[model samples]
Target: MNTTTLTGLELRPLAVPADVSELETPAGHDFATMMDVRNRVYFEISGHHDESMSAAELLPHYQPNPDEIRFMWVAILDGEFVGRAGIDIPLEEGSKTAFWQIELLRKSWGKGVGSAAYELLENKAREHGRTVLQSWASHPAADGVEQIEPPTGFGSIPDDHAAHFYKRHGYSLEQVERNSAFDLRGSFEIVERLLAEATAAAEGYRVVQWEPPTAEEYVAGYAWMKSRMSTDAPSADLEFDEEVWDAERIARHDALWTDAHQFVLVTAAQHIATGELCAFNELVVGKDRAEASHQEDTLVLKEHRGHKLGMLVKCAGLVKWRELVPHSPRVLTYNAEENRPMLDINEAIGFTPIAYGGAWKKVLE
Candidate 1:
């Protein structure tokens, strides 16, 4: 699809082929520029300087995945790239939703570029048989707004921000999330104390740690715990499906991480009597920029609740991650506004709220 704004700018999908070889040709240059624009827009909006993803880090996301169909496009005005947009459509029959994103340089705002880009994305989503379209936008907390109360499906930000942008486009707020950060360079005494306490509380459960390419013996169990994350985690009002996982899927994910030069530290709680993996958490550090890491998935199986295993696995994983990447300055994580348990653990470990964002959804009629 092609869209022309009133200012004579055009929006269209990138001409790069779906093959990996494009990364080495002239298309590679455009891809890099596109990533730069995305990074700039993200930082400008989120006010988080250290969290931007580098080109190497974003490569895996652009690479084709068997279970997901991705589309990337750019908006050009006067022969200059001004905006980028994309959608990720799950190939599963049960999932009729698409996750979409649109990022434009600051200069392009107030123009019709974003609207045109979003319209194209909506058309693509409908063309793919998607019934629901979801997008997320980050907003920095106002000055002196230290402790933000959980959102109530509404925001107080000005109408020009992302929250209002989605609202104006007919999307309803489904859930709110807080982006928090834990300074890894700070004293480890708190983490150690939490670990000791959790270890004592979660009796009969031993902690196991591993890096990429999970051991042959634990692959199936690891995949099982990973699968539970989707169903067990608090998703608020969003429609989601229980992710299907297996040993092969785990291997494929690990390969992607390896190719992205990400160092993954996974720690899980193994029940002693049953020999079952009951809980697990993952911490991934990007090799390209070691100053920051991301807290991925942390899940405790339904049958194992109230064992303090969540704290146990998270603490163990953080410790191992710091050991592997001592120079990493901080770790970032996101949790639903209603997820008190995870938030409690995060706060107790010195993670402070950095920003707030919400999941916006629109049901296409």
Candidate 2:
């Protein structure tokens, strides 16, 4: 079937030979343009982390059997690839949800290309059995290298152009999300003071780390910690899609950590109660790149509260991380923006305001 036409754009089952070669051939140039457009639009709309795109950094997504990607939809206008959109479904089995990320080269906008591409992609999603169509849309902005505050959890959108786009189809809000980050290498004096304060408060708690725990033990520990996390987090009122963090789920997470940095803090008994802290961090480093670590989930159980266990755990992890990866310049984290208490804790540890990563959601029926 003809997947290309002069009438505007066409949608076809993303095939290997055609799609891969097209992307791989001019991958560098294509990625640079893609990155430029992404940064431009995001910077103009909502000030946030804007960086020049490099093809080498994007090559991995097109590499052999990368698991993070689900499908790709390309926009062809006047016989040139003008934009791309895709769904990134984490490979964990039984995950009922998936995420949407869309980018249009600046020149491609205002031509109805976005509408056409999304309709095709949405239909493709249904074919793939997608129950939810989630898209992360941001306000329009000019591209820059500096960081800006991301809009509310779901992104800035009184404009709601994107929301209307989804609504005109069939998407609705699921839940909102927010983000935050810290400067780890700012000043030793400040770091030392934060450490001292946290240490003073953590009288009896001792930090610990280990390889994969026994399946039964891992499941139990995660279950306990997850329950506490749910209630302690800002979303305590929202209905969680998943009930238990079981062994199989934990294992699936472990499988992704081929080069991940993980740490957990526990009491002398190794039991996870309030006052105990746990976190997982993903490391990103390069000589020419800004060194940053993404702090995934930091949890302090209910029983472990009030003693400043959260601060202690985070401090311990930071100190150890510095000792281990001294070159890492900063740490990034995301929490519901209204999560003030935790935000205060993060600020105490030197996490500065970076960008507003709004969490916009649209339900699928």
Candidate 3:
């Protein structure tokens, strides 16, 4: 069925085809255009195409997932696709929080198109019984732009266009996340030195590494660590449901990366005696080996802190990642500004801050 598009300023749910190959069919037309606008919009904001992805690379995420229900829409202003919005509703029991995003070309701002699309998203969230809504947007540091700091008192982000919009819509800045990048082409002397220190500090743990489809003996431990990401990470006021993961969820997660033709490396810390996986770090690169690599999730369980596992896993991941994808120029990662421990590790590994993103939230009646 054709997606419902209203007049010139239409904001309608994107109708995706069963597969990316269906892009040739009318069914995939909206999906293709949305991906295009998404890419251009990001590049315009960051001046880097690191976040760009082909529709095929993003389709699996838009597909139905048992854990998160996705609602995506495209905005057409005067018969041209100019923007897109999405909401991901986590299926935890009694969930009242939904994470959403609204992206549009800079030229489309102040046209009321974003407001229209937001109404579409807010209405859907209310329909799903959601009470709290959260979203994030990169706020590039500008020389004269005012800045807003979260109550957590860690990092501050420019109160630029996105911040103004969020304030106008009743959302409060709860946290700021730092977007950091490590120069892979630079020397790894610091990384190797820190790895040795972390290794010595983590006396009872050893580094274990793998790709997708986690090994049989490590599935349970890996799944448990993955679940803790929802709670173990620092979030001052942003709401997140405690996710439960198992072998099936791991398989599904692995399949998403594999199907997208992306290479992923998982470096984890295992307890020497109990064989428990205490920490993990992930590095991912798209089909093009030369493109920027992404540092996905790096977590050290709360009970396992103070052992420098965070640094151990991170340095280990980067050390191996260079050998895995020798040509990838750089690695990018994000962490809450309040997460000083992780930020400290990244800084010691030669990561430099490139941008800051604001985490905003609003509550509905």
Candidate 4:
């Protein structure tokens, strides 16, 4: 792709080997400067840390090969990183399309830097074999209802401008899931109560915990959980290929745990009613800081919903966490503002709301 200027900006992918040294500078060196652009454009605009931007977390989703998962585009003005976008090709089941996630520095908005980045990405997608593109576009708080619009050629929107931007592009709404998250440090008590209530509601069904009989024993359970999850959870448009995530992937997670952290779950005979407490947590260790785990991917089966299994298994996990990791600080989570059921349980626990927003996806067709 040739370099092009849009509204006085240059947009391109960070060339590795050449840019690695530049991008890897210490956080103190240029961390906040680079992070501020991303946090404001992506996080702050979406009701996340609306005031002060936190340090950059792990590179959104890191894969061994950049070509396999994400294509990052950045816009520079006077040599300063001002805007950026990411094309996440999540190799998960049922997600059939490539989507775009766009972010803009506060000062960079209103200029065409975002548009330039989009055009470059769109062209790159066409070069690679991406036919249909999809994005989860958010409406401004003023717009109210969540809408997914069709992708035009180039141009993306921040969460707030998702509805208007996509509508302008020509995409149609395929799905909308109200995502939710919760902090789990001591929040397990509430999850336990919810589990009890759900179990009580599920009269004939029994919830049991199963530890892998052997390291290999998890294949069946993992497959069962994956298939059952495919049936129950919200459709994130992930395309299920040859089980890209398996025991090996799970074991990698197991490695991240201290003796205190273990994967636990509550399940019916063949179905996982609720329990992904350990799976969703994204644990990362920084240079100077201790490891932090983000509790995510909490889900209960559809038929198991009314029984309050959601709360129960979560609580069960929390109790286990407390017993095991007594020295940890707060566990963290983030949910789309609309997911109320989990929100209900989270509030019941002591997980005070921290950040709220939507994840945007744009497809190139």
Which runs in model 1 stand beyond 4 Å of their true positions? 5-7, 15-24, 143-160
Candidates, ranked, TM-score: 3, 1, 2, 4
Residue 187 error for model 1, in Å?
0.9
lDDT of 4: 0.49
lDDT of 1 by residue, 64-114 (tens): 677789998988877888879999998765888899998888898877787
What is the TM-score of candidate 2?
Answer: 0.65
Pick by lDDT: which candidate is best? 3
> Candidate 2 lDDT, tens digit per residue, 1-365?
22432366654333333232354555344544554555565555545442323334443444334334567655557766665677756444554456666666667666777777666566656666666656655434235433233233333323345555655666544334444566666665666677688667766655554334334544556555654554566652232244456666565554333112232222211334553234322233332334555566666655556766666666766666666667666776776656666777887777766544334444456
Per-candidate TM-score against the hidden true structure: 0.92, 0.65, 0.97, 0.64
TM-score for candidate 1: 0.92
Error of 4 at 45 (Å): 2.4
Among these predictions, the greatest TM-score belongs to 3
Q: lDDT values of the candidates?
A: 0.81, 0.53, 0.91, 0.49
Give the lowest summed-lDDT range of ten residues in model 1: 147-156
When 2 and 3 are scored with lDDT, the better candidate is 3
Q: What 10-residue stretch in candidate 3 is worst by lDDT?
A: 1-10
Q: Kindly report which residue stretches of model 4 are placed more than 4 angstroms away from their true locations once superposed.
A: 15-36, 40-43, 46-60, 65-67, 90-96, 137-160, 173-192, 199-220, 223-231, 236-244, 252-293, 301-308, 322-365
Give the alpha carbon lDDT tens digit for every residue of 1-365 in model 4.
Answer: 43566645766564422222344555233433545676566564557432232333332223244225777656777677886666766465454556676677667666666667766767766765675565543333444444332222212223345454544555454444332334444445456666577557645444444332224544544544544544455444432233344666555433323222333332222234443221211222222222333454566645446655566555655555555445545556654334567667777766774433333444554
Better of 1 and 2 by TM-score: 1
